[model samples]
Target: MKDRKYNTTEKQQTRKTIQRNVNSEKINSKENKANNEKVLDNKKILIISLVVVVTFITILIVTGVFDSGVQQNVTQMNTESQNSTVNMANMQEINNLENKIAANPEDMESTLHLAHLLQDSGLFEKAVTNYKNYLIKNPANADARVDMAICYYNLNDYNTAIAEMENALKYQPKHQIAHLNLGIVNLTARNMEASKEWFKKTVEIDPNSDAGKRAQELLTSH
Candidate 1:
């Protein structure tokens, strides 16, 4: 009887050990499952955050905020390229005219052409030299004198511009362009009264001409 009881007690202890191990495994499995779910939730949150960032960038692209700047840069580049091309062509023409005039120093036509080109190219001193050369033989050319006056005006020599314009008027008393340009030059030189007088003369010359209409506008505004 004592041996049987001892065996039964040993068996009971073994069963209790088994039961404890099974319960510990259940708790560990529950903890593992919870940890996996937490990891999945974190991954989902990260994916959603990435999606939000991508969507925001897409919206910005669609709104033209980025495209406008790119278009403006392209437009500016194209304009600069066109201006450079035009300058190159003008320089070539100037060189050709210079060569022609050098071969025939008395070529007043080439001299005037070169002067016009140089004035347009903003070489005021060189243009003045060519204009003086042309005027020495063609002093009665009111148009040429007016053009030279414009060169002086651009050089900021307001007094010389005025005198040149007046000389042009001496050749062509009704030179509307000369009068209008004198008004512009006087305005730049801060001689408002002289500017107004020139503008009035321009209008009196021909009220329907472009220069006269421009002078009229200036008189009304100033």
Candidate 2:
């Protein structure tokens, strides 16, 4: 009876141990499934983060604000450069004009321009020389003779100025400038009668001109 009772108790204990082992394996499988779910969630979050970063970068590119700023900077630089080039071109043109005048000493137009430049610079002696050279080369030029007379008058050589006016008059007696300049020279030299005669002649030459009207006023005034 005691042996039978011991065998029955041992069999029950072994069956209980096997049941505990089966329950342990089921618990381990549940834990593994939870860990796999967590890993899957992490992979999904990583993919979402990558997509967000790529989309943000794409948005920045699509806005084109950065490109506009770059374009504006380039345009501003180009405009400044073009302005500088224009300024340089203007300076070169001025230099070229000066060079042309210097290279052609005997050119009538250049000589005239140089004389005016010298006069403007207060270089009276050089201005006179240039005007005299022009006159010598272009003796038939009535306007140049008048210009020379003006230069001589500026140099205080009234007698030579009057002589030039007389020479211009010989070419065309009705020349208004010649008459007006002669009248002015005579008045400066204190020859009242000669001044009167030339002023009257200027009025007769061009009654519609300002010089003629002024000459008429001077003739009547005194």
Candidate 3:
């Protein structure tokens, strides 16, 4: 028997079977490698997501974004303390004012009242000093100016008294007392024209005023 000769069909069938087995094995190995790689990728993604979430939470805590509530409480406490201090100071000052007003010589009451008492006691300069002090603190005190003008009147400083009275009247246009008093002070200085004008205004503004009655009394003498 000559060496058995393989036919083309048999040779081809053999090659096909070998090639199929090799291809099948290559396909299985590639599938296993791909599955392993996919699992690794999934694990890496999960770890990265966890890290990002944790970092975001840490940043929020560190930046004081979470401390707003605590800061508000502290602010409220400070404000309350300031208000308490102010209220205490006001109470103390008001109490002192009441005590000061109830006493004598050194007692400071209404600017007008204190100055009037000192003037009546014949301390012209001292009365003037007190009125000046009062005016310094309460410059718009009309009642105090009236008393100050009277003090000047007693000092025979008719010009000063008239000026102070005019300042008082400027604040109170309808001040019947101011008009009447100004008229008399003008009369003593023989400012007849000014006195007549003031007396006429006093009569028109408040005919029932003591100043008006005083003017009428003076008229009867004239």
Candidate 4:
């Protein structure tokens, strides 16, 4: 009987030992699963952060925030090229006009045309030379004389401009444009009284004319 009791007790102790070992393994498995899930979550967060950074950079590019400087440079270069081409064309036309005038010194029509063209092109000194030559032959041309005076005004020779405009008036008194231009020149020269007088005369000459209306406006404003 004692031997049987001892064997039974030993078997029970061995079963308890095995049961405890199984429970310990179950707990270890639970802990290992939780640790693996945490690692996966961290990896997901890292991937999402990388995606957000890349998306922000792409948006900046698409919105032109980084490309504005390049666009400006391209636009400026195109404008410069166009302006250069236009200047070259204008210079060519001027050269042709000079050649024509040089070939025929006595062609008054061509000479006057060249003078007007040169004045339009802002070659004031050269235009004055041509105008002087033309006026010597056609001194009674009030229009051309006024135009030459305007060139003198542009050249800032106020005294000469005033003198030439007066000469135009002597040829054609009551010339509205000459009067208006004299007003303009006098105003630029700070001769307020002379400017007012000329403006008044321009209006008195012909109130319905363009120059007269312009003169009236100047008188009212100034």
Point to the candidate with the largest TM-score.
1
- Distance from true location, Cα of 68 in model 3, Å: 95
Backbone collision tally, model 1: 0
lDDT, candidate 2, residue 83?
81
Give the root-mean-square deviation of each candidate in angstroms.
4.4, 16.2, 18.7, 6.1
> What tens-digit string does per-residue lDDT give for candidate 3 at 8-100?
667789999999999998998899899999999999999999999999989988987778768878999999999888667655654454356
Clash pairs detected, candidate 2 = none
lDDT string, candidate 1, 1-222, tens digits: 999999999999999999999999999999999999999999999999999999998998999878998999999999999999989999999999999988999999999999999998899999999999999999999999999999998888999999999999999998899999999999999999999999999999999999999999999999
Full-model lDDT, candidate 2: 0.82
**After best superposition, candidate 4 residue 117: deviation in angstroms?**
1.3
- Would you list the C-alpha lDDT of every candidate in the order shown? 0.95, 0.82, 0.79, 0.92
Candidate 3 overall lDDT versus native: 0.79
lDDT tens per residue, model 4, 5-109: 999999999999999999899998999999999999999999999999999989989999779878889999999999888778767877887788789888888
TM-score of 3: 0.49
Which 10 successive residues of model 2 have the least lDDT summed? 89-98
> What does candidate 4 score on TM?
0.67
Candidate 4 has an lDDT of: 0.92
Q: lDDT winner among the candidates?
A: 1
